[model samples]
Target: MMDHTDQTTVLTHAGVMAMLAAAIAEAEATGQPQCIVIVDGSGELLGEVRMTGAKYLSRKSARSKARTAASIGAPTTAIPDAVRAPIGAATGGEMTALPGGLPIKVGGVLLRGIGVGSGSGDQDVAVGLAALRAIRAATEF
Candidate 1:
């Protein structure tokens, strides 16, 4: 038997930086600045970036979005409207019902979550998606 042993994949600094770069690039192409947050599977921050001209307060929401995505292994928007408020209150707003958060998976392993804020929901999601795409090449074996 394996005797209570397990394995896990984690995000690296380089991977986090690559994702940040992708998010920033997407934001630029869309003519919007954003605050992007990256978290590990356990909802711990690995990296974050607040682009110039982004709303400063958006960083808080971005962090919540990233944590929500990592904790649920799904987009933060997946939280049902009825439960969203309760969940947020229960967790002291650690979770959010935003559309900008995405689970970061590579080769079937859920390694991280990325969240973008300070733009429209669609724009935030686009930036998050671009970040995910950029990390695939860097993280996938």
Candidate 2:
């Protein structure tokens, strides 16, 4: 049986804005234009930003990446190929198997996801991780 009334931690609008700022800062520091997307635990879009000069296609890719991470409750890179292939197919490519999407968790509970695009995988992952670190620092006492 599932408890529909169970309390869950969710990303606040301010928190999502903070994440976007952090990610943009990181991308700027690296001289890489990026598109960043934030999504709730249920895969709903919370916030998004497309940096100046970022690829137009990145907007959609970033959203899919965020949705993938939130839907699976894990970093996109950590999804095993065995599962990734099927989910990617099932979702008609709505899910991405890329390295730049990260699940945001607090106290072992998934809260949201952050995804970065319009850069190399490493660059995207770096920006996403920096945003996660910023969120944790802001929220922790």
Candidate 3:
């Protein structure tokens, strides 16, 4: 029998929406059209939004970035190109080495990942980080 003793914490739908709102607000503040994606720990998409005037390709890129971060349990930017290139190829380009992807965690337990695209890497990262901060501010975990 498999032991099921370990407990896992996941983000609620409300939490995901809160993050999205914050990300969108950040993008608006900077006058940046952006695409944002949120994924659960299993790399399943939880929520997504593409702001007005965002590039068409940004939707897919944001999803890929979120999935990559969730799969690796780290920020996508932290993955070296040496490691990311092959993985990107192996995954049929479902992964991205973008800097806007961040893993969402609480007390060492990963909850999800948030990714932003259609802006400069720095701007995307700022939006993603803002989302994480919003979640932290709204919830205890």
What TM-score, over all chains together, does every model reach?
Answer: 0.91, 0.88, 0.91
Q: For each candidate, what is the lDDT?
A: 0.88, 0.85, 0.87
Predicted model with the maximum lDDT: 1
Model 2: per-residue lDDT, tens digit, 1-141? 877796666678888888889899999999999999998888888999999999989988888889888888877887887887898888888898887888888877777887899999999999998889777753321
* Tens-digit lDDT track of model 3 for 72-110: 888888888688789888888788898898888877877
* Model 1 lDDT per residue over 1-141, tens place: 567865666577987898899899999999999999999888888999999999999999999999888888788899888999999999998999988999887767777888899999999999999998886664432
Q: Order the numbered candidates by lDDT, best leading.
A: 1, 3, 2
CA lDDT, candidate 1, residue 131: 90
What residue pairs are clashing in model 1?
A: none
Best-matching candidate per TM-score? 1
Clashes of 3: 0
